[model samples]
Target: MKVLVLGGDGYCGWPTSLHLSDAGHEVVIVDNCVRRQIDHELATQSLTPITDMKQRVKAWQEVSGQTIAVEFGDLLDWEFISDVVRRHQPDAIVHFAEQRAAPYSMIDRRHAVYTQHNNVVGNLNVLFAIQEFVPECHLVKLGTMGEYGQPNIDIEEGYIEIEHNGRKDVLPYPKQPGSWYHLSKVHDSHNIAFACRIWGMRATDLNQGVVYGTVTPQTERDPRLINRFDYEEVFGTVLNRFCIQAAIGHPLTVYGKGGQIRGFLDIRDTVRCIELAVENPAEFGEFRVFNQFTEEFSVNQLAEMVVEAAGKLGFEARIDNIPNPRVEKEEHYYNAKRTKLLDLGLQPHYLGDSLLDSLLNIALEYRDRIDPDVVMPSVDWREGRAKQRVHKAPAQPSASL
Candidate 1:
């Protein structure tokens, strides 16, 4: 299969690109390198040193003997995306090109607007590009579990069958997105459903959970091919952040009562889920939704797990309860259905097993790079003031072209 991985230089996108390429699919990466730029703007860097695109793909080719083509462009530009679609005519497109941080989106008005425009408009362009060129191409879009918010019911895959007013209808799950970034994803989901209904397009919306782990089979091949491990307030995920804190002997900062619960999966499972979605394409005129996660854990549970994992390595880790920066329920029912991926042959990797080797040890390995200042809650959900200084990210070096 010829696959085009948009935002293929990003944390999840980079590893997914390599996984597909290694599985013998012809992969072409399309990215503007904005993620790297965002790190520059936040005065933060990946805890693990990541190489540039040239070095990354070059190392992958040498290690796996697979060629993954890369193109420098933005998805918001219709002409650019349309031309690429027409030229490549890929069998599938794994769309991962968008601003993905919730806190960053909630920072200020400008950031909010940028997140929505970049994500919503860019997704629209991808839909139009597919409609124009490859109507048969399967679109594997990355949606977020955050889009569901904390609904007071068991969240179905993407829709629910409800009997309201003596009539039964299956509808897209009600979205209560907590941040602008998640709202953009909800908007994208609606747009894709509309497109599938009207244009006979096929798509699989993977409402993926928070991903953890930094190592995959492809990434372990070389140091330069390593993936990003971000542990800052804006981009760092909860479990990853806890691991970093434990490694640095800092208390795991738990927002509010730390009862907030969400789904999580290892980086290895993420790549496999992508493969499962691609291998079994959604039917034409179908917009399939899969709750792509292996396990669920509360914020407090994750902190405890990290503490125990740290103890095994001769480090004492503690938890600190802080005021919740975001407006959300600290405690709520969060039983979400995630059987689709498992049915598709996904062997789950529990957080307990990977806690030490995959996360804490990696943090320990890079202890020198861990910055304590950016570890705590910085963004305020009530106030729209930007937490981190916003700067124009410098352009990627021309060698990537």
Candidate 2:
């Protein structure tokens, strides 16, 4: 199968591109290299040194004897995306090209607007391009579990059968996005679903959870092919952040009470899940949704896991409960259904002491590169809320599709 991986320079996208190419698929990666630019803007870089795009492709070829094509441009440019789609006419398009940091999105009004414009507009272009150039192309969009935002009721896959009155109808799962970044994803979900219904396009919206780890089978082939490991407060996931903190003797910064439970998956499983979605294409005129995560953990639970793992390595890691930067439920019911991916033969790499050890070892290798300032939270969710108690703002409220 011919596959096009958008945002191929990103943490997940880079590895996924290599994985698919290694599996004998003809792969082409389209990216604007905006992630690297973002690193510059934040004054933070990937914990693992990353190769330039040409070097990365060259390294992959050297390691695996497989060639993956590359296209450099923003997805927001309709002509560029349309040209790529028309030329490649790929069997599947793995869409991961977006501004994906929730904290970054909430930093200021400019960042918030850019997040929406880049993510939402880029997604729209992809859908329309697919609709016009290759209606049969299967779009595997990267949605987020953050779209659900700790719903009180058990979170369904993508839609739920509700009996509100005397009638029964299945509706798109309610989206209570926690930040502007997540809200943009929610918008993409709605737009893609509508496109599928009206234009007979096929798509799979993988409502993915917080992805951890730094290496995959393909990335492990060469140092240059290594995926990005971000431990900064704005871009890093909780588990990865904890591992870095443990490595540097920094306290595991658990926000608020650290009872904020969320789903997580290894980097390996993320690539596998994308493969599964590609091989098992959605039906024409169908917009399928899969909850893509292996396990669930709270912020404190993750910190404790890191602490225990660090103890085995003779490192004293402690947890520090900091005032929450984001307005969210410190404790909430988070029963999200994730059986679809497993049913699709996803053998998950569950978080264990060994896995934690591997992550810590990686962080320790680059301990000198760890900047103490970037790891600490800088963006407050609300103005003046960081120092004083103010009226709590609602979690970015949910919108009905």
Candidate 3:
């Protein structure tokens, strides 16, 4: 299949592009390098170094001898995006191109607006680009689990049947986004669904959970091919951050009661899910939504898991309870339905100690690069900078603020 991958430089996008290219597909990736710019803005580098775009393509070519095309342009621009669709006429387009960080979205008013404008406008541009050219092509968008928040109901994939009084109707699931970034995702879903219904477009909204791990089977084979791993407070996911913390002998920063439960997918499974979505395209005028997660655990549970994983490798690790920076339920009930992907033959690479160990071993290689100050939560979700309150723990150095 011919494939076009947007946001190909992103955390998940880079690996997905390689995976598809390796699987005998003609793949073309597009990125604006916002991620690199963000790293520049924050002065935080990825925990695991990634090859520059040119070098990555060169390495992939050497290994597979298959050319993965790349076009560096702002997909948010209608002309640039539509021209690609017309030129490539790809069978499928994977949309992992959005403002993905929750905390980064909440950093300030300017950051919040950037999240809203960039996410929504870029998504709208993609929809229009598809409608204009390659209307038969499939669009697999990477939505987030945070769009549902911690609702007190079994979170369906993307729709729910609510029977209030005698009226029974099935509707898109209620959106209770917790942060500005999540809100943008909700808006994207609305716009995508509308375009799918009105203009007859194929779209799949994969409500993905927090992804973890740095090394996949393909990545483990070549150090140069290791997927992007960011451990700073801004770009890092919870488990990735924990791995860095444990490797550097820093106490795991547990916010509030550390009971915030969320679904999780291994980096390998994330790519697998994307492959399945692309292989089985959604029908025109049908917006398919799948909860793309295989496991569920709380923040504390993940911290404990990381600690144990690192301990097996002879690393001393500990957790430090700290005040939660984000305005969210530290403790909540979270039961989400995620059978759609499994029904599509998504055999999950569940988070095992072996996998966690592999992820940590990669982190251990860059232990010297682990900035102790960058591991803790910095971008609090609240309106003000409430996360910077200095409180020492046991007369010792506190976790990063």
Candidate 4:
């Protein structure tokens, strides 16, 4: 399959692009380097030293001997996306280009609008590009499980069966998005569903969980092929944050009671899930949704796992229950159905099995790069910036390293 990967330079996008290319698909990466720019804006870098885009592609080609074409342009540019679609006529297009951090989105009003404009408009352009040039091309969009928030009941993949007034109908599941970033995803999902219904477009919205790990088969081939491992307050997931703290002997700052639960998966499984979705394209006029996660754990559970994982490497890490900056349900029941990809032969990488090799060891290797200041929560859900930044455990001295 000829595959077009939007946002192919990002954390998930870069690895997925390589995986597709290694799987014998002709892959083209479309990105504007906005993620790198954001790193600069935030005065933070990935825990792993990632090479530039050109060097990354060069190293991958040298390692895998597979050529992946790259185009530098924003998705908001209709001409660029439309031309790419017309030129490649790819069998599938994996959409991963968006501002993905919830904390980043909740930073302020400007950031909020930017997140929506970038994510929603970019997705709309992709839909239109497909509609105009390659109607048969499957759009595999990266949606978030956060779009559903934490409902009292079980979360379906994307839609739910409802019987109202003695009539049975399946409707798009009700969204209670917690942040502006998630709201953007919700908007994109609705837009994709609309396009499919109105124009017979095919799309798969993969509502992915919190992806952990910094390595994949393709990324492990070369150092330059290493993917981004964000451990900052804004972009870092809970698992990444905890592992980084453990690496530097910083206390694992668990926000609130640490009862917040969400689904998670390894970086390897994330790429495989993409391939599975691409191989099994959704039908025309059908917008399929797959809850793409292998395991579920609360924030406290994740911290505990990280502590144990770090202990195996001779690191002692303690948990610090901090005030929850984000206005979310600290404790909620979350059981989301995720059988679609499993039925499609998704062999999941469980957290318990791969934590040491996938995350903790990487954190220890890059212990020198761990910025202690950025490990704490800075963005408040209600007021954007918190009244006071909390840093209970300062990073251990570099001399100790």
Best by TM-score: 1
TM-score of 1: 0.97
RMSD (CA, Å), candidate 1 to true, equals 3.1
Kindly list the per-residue Cα lDDT of model 3 for residues 187-237, writing each as its tens digit: 999999999999989899999999998665666556677678888887788
Candidate 2, position 173, lDDT: 85
TM-score of each: 0.97, 0.95, 0.94, 0.95
lDDT of 1: 0.90
Stretches of candidate 1 off by over 4 Å are 387-401
Q: Taking the tens digit of each residue's C-alpha lDDT, what string does model 1 give over 1-401?
A: 99999999998999999999989899999999999888877888999999999999999989888888998998877889999999999999999999999988887777777888889999999999999999999999999999999999999999999999999999899999999899999999999999999999999999999999889999998999999999999899988899899888888999999999999999999999999999999999999999999999999998888888787777799999988999999999999999999999999888774455568889989989988878887778898866455443222222221
Evaluate candidate 4 by giving its C-alpha RMSD to the native, one decimal.
5.9
Model 4, 199-231: lDDT tens digits are 999999999999988898889999999999999
Question: Could you give candidate 2's per-residue lDDT for residues 198-312 as a string of tens digits?
Answer: 9999999999999999888889888889889999887888888999999988989999999999999999999999999999999999999999999999988899999999999
Q: In candidate 1, which residue pairs get closer than 3 Å at backbone N, Cα or C atoms, i.e. clash?
A: none
Off by over 4 Å in 3: 384-401
The 10 consecutive residues of candidate 2 with the worst lDDT sum are 389-398
Worst 10 residues of 3 by lDDT: 389-398
Lowest lDDT sum, 10 consecutive residues, model 4, at: 392-401
Residue 52 alpha-carbon offset, candidate 1, angstroms: 0.3
Ranking by lDDT: 1, 2, 4, 3
Please give the ranking of all candidate structures by TM-score, highest first, separated by commas: 1, 2, 4, 3
